[model samples]
Target: MARSARLAAQGLAIGLVVGLLTLLVWRVANGNGKGVAQALADGEHPTAPAFDLSRLDGRGRFDLASLRGKKPIVLDFWASWCVPCIHESRRLEAARKEYGNRVAFIGVDTKDFSGDAREWQKKHGITYPSVHDGSGSVLTKWGGLPIPRIFFVARSGKVVGELIVEEDLPRYLREIAAS
Candidate 1:
């Protein structure tokens, strides 16, 4: 009888562990783990932090405040060495082309060498302007590390959504466009 009781207890513990793991996986897959979706759902639209950074290709600077009221802005934080950034860069370029003048796309190259960032952009044939955040101060101001983080700011200068995964980016962009 004691042996049967012990086996039942072990099975219950295993079931609880499995349930917790499943919940975590579901939360991550549905974008709840990052709290981004929850924040948006709670009507917590915050103004995107302002920053002025030089362009990667020796071009002029990009001022966040300058983009306000002009068009919807898409800010993508990336690094040249991050593999996922490469894939997301292509998707962003395609989205930029599709959206045309309706939206403004800006890439923030954080924690990467200027030469490497410029080379990556050139190799990828990226035409959008990219800001250099070598010191990562801008990244810190916006949020912490995580290469390939994206923020969608509406025309009014309010950040509507944030995304970490590249796969969910297009859907988020579409939702922004629709808004």
Candidate 2:
């Protein structure tokens, strides 16, 4: 009985160690586990990175540099395969309508097929322009991971906030517009 109990304890200990190691590996692989929340918490509101990409609809090119000093800009990083983005899409369209010309809403469709992204936007009735980030260069530039990451930028081109939850976006948009 004593030997059996010792063996059981050893097995448990090994399992625990393996579990911890797996978690650590997963976290490190996924943006170092410092997502949008951590970026905001760091209190370093960096300048919004400038990018130029083809429009998702293939209409024309979308340039971030042109938006500087124009108005508050909301950059939403999303992918069609991402479930959360489907829900967030509705909120974004609503916010865009609510704000109505006071802010510029841009969607960055990252790591997704252009046709799929375009279809997704069409299904969601997204009127705001979206750019295809097929290479994920824009995502890396903004240090964003995980779909549905929203970055709020002031008129001065400085990032004001980073949000993952959709509910908080409207309030942030209202405040940014008012300011």
Candidate 3:
């Protein structure tokens, strides 16, 4: 009986340690230090995940496949409340001005309210269309673990570039254009 009690105590201790470790890992992985996005941009060409969501412009649904034949599209995952996203939005608007018909810009507001996203668009003078992924379902598929992520999908229907920093954004766009 004493041996059984010792085993039970050991099992409980192990479970508590595991639970604490998991919480620590979660905090580190999803913290504001730019985790998965940076690793992905530096590592490899992640498989383009299917993203289907409703456009904020009420122009029906926006499916990733449907934007294939058009110009290269940049799908930016952001939220209205994120400061970095605000900066990224300005850069995206500049890109739109520069490329015009040569490129398409789409913003996905993850886990955000529709009113806030719409207000942000108006405040920022964003001419491009945006969609809300409030449920984070599409975000998970796109592998967007954090806010302020950018995916540059080439005209040939391939995600050739991604950027995590505002400084690297234009460079990525230039690379996409050259490619």
Best by TM-score: 2
Order the candidate numbers by TM-score, best to worst: 2, 1, 3
What lDDT tens digits, residue by residue, belong to model 1 across residues 1-179? 99999999999999999999999898779632334334565778877778999989787998999988877888888988999888777888988988857888999999999999999999987888899999988777666577687889888888888775555677767766665
What residue pairs are clashing in model 2? none
lDDT of 2: 0.82
TM-score of 1: 0.72
Error of 2 at 37 (Å): 6.8
Off by over 4 Å in 1: 1-43, 165-167
Query: Highest lDDT among the candidates is held by which one?
Result: 2
Better of 1 and 3 by lDDT: 1
- Candidate 2 lDDT tens digits, 12-69: 9999999999998887788434443456679876777789899887889998889788
lDDT of 3 by residue, 45-117 (tens): 5445667789987889888777676567788888888887887788889888887577778888899998888
lDDT score, residue 123, model 1? 91
Give the residue spans of candidate 3 off by over 4 A.
1-42
Better of 1 and 2 by TM-score: 2
What's the best-to-worst order under lDDT?
Answer: 2, 1, 3
